[model samples]
Target: MPNGQGGYQPIFILSEGTRRQRGHEAQESNIQAAKTIGEAVRSTLGPRGMDKMLVDSLGDVIITNDGATIMDEMDIEHPAAKMIAEVAKTQEDEVGDGTTTAVVLAAKLLEEAGELLDQSIHPTVIASGYGMAAAKAQEFLNDMAVSISIDDEEQLKQVAKTAMTGKKVEANVPVLAGLAVKAVKQVAEETEEGYEVDLDNISIEKQVGEGVDNTFMVTGIILDKERVHPGMPKSVENAKIALINAAMEVKETESDSEIRVSSPEELQKFLDQEENEFREMVAKIKEIGANVVICQKGIDDMAQHFLSKEGIFAIRRAKKSDMKKLARATGGKIITDIEDMTIDDLGKAGLVEERKISGENMIFVEECENPKAVSVLVRGGTEHIVEEAKRSFEDAVSVVAKSIESGKIVAGGGATEVELSMKISDYADSIGGKEALAVRAFANAVESIARSLAENAGLDTIDTIVELRAKHEEDGAVYGLDAHDGEVKDMMSEGVVEPLLVKTQAVSSGSEAAVMVLRIDDVIASKGNEVGEGGGPEGMPGGMY
Candidate 1:
């Protein structure tokens, strides 16, 4: 190569292996990545949706139709695909449902944006149109929300059932949905805004070897443990329990110290003093009228003997998290020191017993007067079945919790989405400009949610959308595809409902993801670094920018 002077030199701005894409090429690459991810999980959208079996390099398997799970499991490499997956994560973290709707809508937004790009439309114009549509879509969502309350058990159950529908838990939906609602209700408290449910208060414990029918909810905390000593009573009636974080063993000095024993008398005196310390700890527990002691730390052998002798059923080494749940469920304060324990610190339960299940002993703490923390013992015949059922049950719990918190719900089965499309499209028409095309494109992207639901249900996507549009035109916009009947019907009346929060989150995240992809006109990617002899990426000798 030669310059005007017959000599040439080129400057290197980036690393030797760095790859950079500009303009339409970068946009197309990003959009394609998003679309590919969207297509990957699009089929798993509704009750009739298909499940994905993801196996990792270690051969561990996960079979689920959960959009969040699928996205999290996929080993995605593309930056755009990862960003798209983040939408599903945000939807799940925010609302606990409608993850599929979020990703599908984002993909369609980019798909529509791609078409507008072919028409020489500016990316900024498309992004501006999408922003307007997203904001308008949220406004439309508020109009469609119907109030929900704790007293509305039937509606709450319906919400739970809707969340559990597509998971492989059809036969047990009734029982599980009931438990989900009941758990949410039990933990729900009146707040200035409305009902507040802390999902952490509702604990789910899974056990295998029993049929799903045996699954039940406990009104109190359930510990996967047994009494510490064989001599301890297996059950305590009218149990007065103490929740302790401190170990029952004799306290050691803060720094290492040793006693230089000169004779057997000194050693014997030391043994007697240690025994008295153990005796005092157990005596303190019994003196406080606590018949059941749940210790977070170890119980010394001598302390265990004394507790057994005193007829106190003690559980050793309880998890700290479980200790918190017990404190919530029992309405008792957790004491760090045994000396601080008093009669008033004792938590009451009608019965605390250990039961054998699957040949293992698990303690059941039940019949609390009013437990703030509750447990759902998920039982199933196999590991996979139990895992799947637990996931489904938890999703139901989250949905019920969110519904009660928001006090609002919207029609499901794609009804809300189609309605949103109709409303936003009308809004788009009033603003007739280049941006309006992008706004209209946003409306179509939202409609893709319904189309995905229809296609997943094995219905003809085009025909379903046509019928839904027709229904929205003449009848109320609540009419959506009824996958079971293959007809468009009112989702609200049919009891296909979802929390209003999920819908708004899906719209917000989907549009944001699409806009993020569109605004990026250039992408510079660092090449995969080669492993150096020192086991670090070779190209990262200096800080990676």
Candidate 2:
């Protein structure tokens, strides 16, 4: 090290070639990295947004406009960008929609903060101001939210349709929306805290041969397994189903031991004893009067033969999830032991049939009286189409369930974002000084949602924002971007609605991520793995500035 006193001295703090960024440089670099990640997915923000086709290192391709999918598929290396991506993930996991809004909002907030930094404002002031603005934005959201009830099926369908608006299966949204509402409603449970929906109770299965319009909802569970034996009946009417978690095969001893049988007669006796046990197990199931058997584990060959002989429909290797769904749909108990099974343990369904779908045979337990567990079978023209359609359905189903559970909604199409921005800006004027600037920045950041939506729709963003801000200032906050015609319209009258839970989560998570990124003042990176000619610090591709 060179000393200021014109003397040479050796000193070590950071390891040689280790990178360090501190103070203003560190904050600026992190914000830029986060903004880059935000801009990467901002174009995929609304109903008219374009899709991103991300090709991974393995050449696997994902074409989607979903914010969560885009962020997850990208090979992002910057640590700050990864944090911003996590904000989208959190929003997706919590609300199942508004991922793009969350990301774009966070990015815009940092961009605004950077401007404040240039004007000599401190990062702590910006972070603090954002915290207050976030809390107030939540209040505005609650005030604007339209209360609904679980009985409002039409409103719930609108919520699903709104979520599916920008998806690839737009043509099938009406049909898919209906199925999504039905499935979520079937699985919803009433609790002291309003209604709670476990989306897991609603399953989505996809197959590729049919068109998107061919998708349908099953009242009961649809097991991917076919009948265990070809000799078994193809279908059973008035099914009394026995759900077994244990295998039908003869179970071996928990502790292994070698058996020595020198005589051929002794060997035949041992075989006879094992055969008798298998027969007894099947007989017990028959005694229970179960016409259909669903096993979570494998069934022995002899057991299958016996089941077929008794004219009982049997499906082996059923997934635990499917078995649980069966229990709910059929009102049956899952028997753990052969001796423990009884007639009362059997579940009832109108029919249990093995049907061929897309050239694959699958078991369908249909027409359960008031089934609590249901499934949606998604069909499309090709594998990729089916996958994309299924993804769209997942979003629809999740949002519908969320709406039913919360019983509250809001107008979408950037209406809510514009309203929030206006409200927060008014709030900023109430406060004074530099912190107010930060609060105002948060409000402006939120307005980027409307800007991005208009941009994605091929409209002039500046003109759209100017018109939207004027509309909010004069005519209240009902007006928003109408992507279809590139104009501002009332989202409420247009039936473009979303769950309140989605909007609240998006704003809160986005603000939190922005604040986190702004607070970072230091970054220390370890040495890179490879060394090359003319390489910068520790062989990093582009060394830290």
Candidate 3:
């Protein structure tokens, strides 16, 4: 394609309809998209924040103010906006809260970076400054964090309550918070690195009958199923439970075989042998002094009849996961062989009862004095409310778990953000270079969190910021925006606290996302075929700008 002259002629290096955007055009478009995403979730920040009602293409609806939920529900198409949304996801995954704060901070950072770009500052410089500020911001958060322990019930409840402050279940926060702290403490185990909380060990079940206030924690696992046979006991007290993974039925031969039974006597003998096998299995279970049988496999009809005749409460085909949780909750081991069953292998439970709930039968294994696994039953007036309450309870549980694992917490209600802002600005001034501007910009961006809190609460954003800054300067880092009263107060004294890891992770994740988005200077998108090339809408790569 080279011309005869010294230079080469133009060649169609890209596809015929391909389009691209580079340099400032691409950067500005990406920044705008990210900022739009941030604004979408900004109003859903604090206790006074409004919830978003997201409807999918299938007409399924979700109502919540949780940042992660909003991000997940929104069908975002823009790549840059998707990246911003991931900031919230990362925050949610790492600290279990503060997703809104993280995304808002990242959006604000990009907004500030756009202004710097107008002043001839390079994207690299802004990213570098953000990196420095993020590191220092974490340091400030650590310095301000108050030490907590697994035994700090009051503070731990505060953590859970703070996490559930703005959710639909806010009215039941105190009770749910107590349950969250208790559940997390129960499942928490000490590892070599630190205390670890396996959230899976804490199961949350929702039953829509009563109001959210009826939610309570169970010391043992709850099975959604009831007794396998009606003749079995409806309730068992002082129960000796057997955890079985094997089927209480005769095993079929591995190879297919044909049995020729010409006489009725031969058939009767075969039936009698099967009946004896079932009786033997039941005999072994009863011989172990077990009154409650939780099986992971099927129980033959004859076996069920024999167990019911013995007055044992038996539930067959229990989920394997439920079986494991049952083992942990009951301090029992799952036995695979009937011959190995013994009294020593039995688990103790004060009560095992089948209760009728909302016209359905449910099994409750309650009153395990030292059970490791637990369940939280959430009740609400409607299905939607119950679903929302479950989300809120899960958030509370996660936050409490994080607090226990980290053993550090800080004042909430924008207190940590305000303090980090002041500290970061101080560090910016000390740096004294082009990067200092970026660092200062990062500090200003961090203040967006407080502004968002005030804005969501229907307060004057500028006035609230000024007052918060003045108070932080005068009182200390603990002074923060009390959105409830539109006043700057000491968050620590007010019992408004969050896990320190939440704030630190928000800053780090937000900064990383913002920096990554800012560093982009080009966008190349491949458009898929809308229809056949010969008909309908055309398919081609289009420049976002």
Candidate 4:
């Protein structure tokens, strides 16, 4: 080993078996791990991206096209891969639709950087240059973005249509498009002054079992159906509503004096007295017009039978909060005592309904004065599908809301960002300093997002990147480069801007996996002695950074 103080270190002098390695190798490994993870999902990129069926150890299945969901479910042990996962999560959490895109872009940027390194381009330098180019590219793309008036519904539709293309509901494009527009408009109108539309609010939930086809406004509880007992009421109407957090009947009362029941006659007398007392309580409720009852807990069979005979509509097993809501909604009182029940205490029955539409079940409630705030109980066919649909709907709603709130959607999926990075890189050689490297790094980051998305969606990041680059060259434009009309014309003459996401995530996860693997170098491990830690040296356990 070379002495720390100086000259060339002799490899032969060092113990080759030692695990310690160079920082460069570690960095390389991190980069490679990132690439490998990205490549795993490459083929599923773009509108035509493929779906993944994830079956867990329990044989539970999840079929989805969402990049984040897929990545999250995978049993990944690599730290770098986890970092890439974090990026996807960030995109999903922030924009709701760019997970795959971000991953693909990141992978491509890394791959390109690797090639540059092979050509003697320092990673630091390339990173810096990419940053500069990305900034310029962002400015250009921003400049190119066509701003429309707030009332331009057509333009908004165009944006949404672009996103919805080839999606599950593509067949209902016209309907969805109109709904999206309407939803956006509605959100905009309801928002406070200067409030923007948030598309996250526009989500879809599917359900099974008589589905949500017959949805209708409900002013009261939906457990109208009778309980599994003859004592249960068939229906209740024009009755007072009482919410009970406790049991309706009186608790078992101990006799103040212990009576000796040595004979059968004495026992019969006690039973008769108890029965009579119960009947008397039921009579009192009937007299008070307390025909409708909403209990947070269960009702005794005797009480149920009495209520049913009185034509009282009773709903037991109501949630405490929901029961309170019903009370508030109908200006009714909550009673815990069976004896306190009275005819006048009963409130009129509120309305409730359910419906199904578009293969989804919906439960609507009209308990609130503001109809817009009514809860829409969305149901799904399966847990996974339902969850994915919910996520998709949430994204749609959020995007719509945001577009309304901001008056427009920002060019997303880091498309605008990558373009900006590239343009900044174009002039990197002229500016000499750490700034150049920073610029390059920033550009790589932006591009990395695209590569990540492609990889997650199972597309060819390299080919896609190349295609994007070629399109820019042919059009005299760049991925994130935006130009004025004249500049656009020049670019057209030169051949530059080309839409690329569609082709990137359309490959195979294995291809993306391969690309990512090719980029690996260093492997960092943990230092803790956790039980599940894959047996390895501290800070060098699994395929992490």
Q: For each candidate, what TM-score against the reference?
A: 0.94, 0.94, 0.92, 0.59
Q: Tell me each candidate's RMSD, in Å, in order.
A: 4.4, 3.2, 3.8, 9.7
Between candidates 3 and 4, name the one with more favorable TM-score. Answer: 3
Model 2 vs. true fold: TM: 0.94
The CA-based lDDT of model 2 is what? 0.86
Candidate 2, 1-545: lDDT as tens digits: 56889888987887777777788877777777767777778888889988888887798878888889888887666677778889889988988888988988888899899999999898999999999999999999999999888788888888899999988999999999989988888898999999999888988898888799999998998878789899999989999999998988877888988889999999999988888987888889888798899998999998898888999898888888888888998999998887988899999999889999978987889999999999889999987789889989999988988888888899888889888988998999999988999999998998888888998999998999888888888965778888999878888888889999998998899999999989988777767622221212334322211
The global C-alpha lDDT for each of the candidates, from Candidate 1 onward, is 0.87, 0.86, 0.87, 0.50
Clashing pairs in 3: none
Pairwise lDDT winner, candidates 2 and 3: 3
Answer with 1 or 3, whichever has the higher TM-score: 1
- Over 1-545, each residue of candidate 1 has an lDDT whose tens digit, in order, gives 57689788787899988767789887887787777788888988898889989898899999999999888888766677778999999998888888988999998999999999999999999999999889888888998899987899999999999998988888999999999999999999898888889898988999998787788998898889999999999999999999999988878899999879999999999999999999988888888799999999999999999999999999999999998988888888899988888988888888999999898899999998889999999998988889889989988999999999999999988888888888888998899889999989988888888888888888899999988888888867778778877888888898989999989999899999999988998777787733221112343211111
Q: Candidate 4's residue-wise lDDT over 1-545, tens digit each?
A: 55778777756533444343244565555566566666666656545556778888899898777777878887766555676677677666655555666676656666566666666665556654554454455455556453444576665555554454434544434444455555556434444566654332332323433322222223333332343244544433344555556665545657665568999998999877766665776677666656555677777776776666766556667666555545544556677776655544444443432334444332232343322211223334446645554444444444444455544333433344445546656656567875565455445655565554444445566765565555555542323222111111222212221222221221122123323433444343334422122312234444432
Runs of candidate 2 exceeding 4 Å displacement: 1-9, 529-545
lDDT of 1 at 315: 98
- In angstroms, the error of model 2 at 499 is 1.0
In model 2, the Cα lDDT at residue 441 comes to: 94
RMSD of 2: 3.2
Pick out the ten consecutive residues of candidate 2 with the lowest summed lDDT. 529-538
What are the runs in model 1 whose C-alpha is more than 4 Å off?
1-8, 529-545
lDDT of the structure predicted as candidate 3: 0.87
**Rank by lDDT (best first):** 1, 3, 2, 4
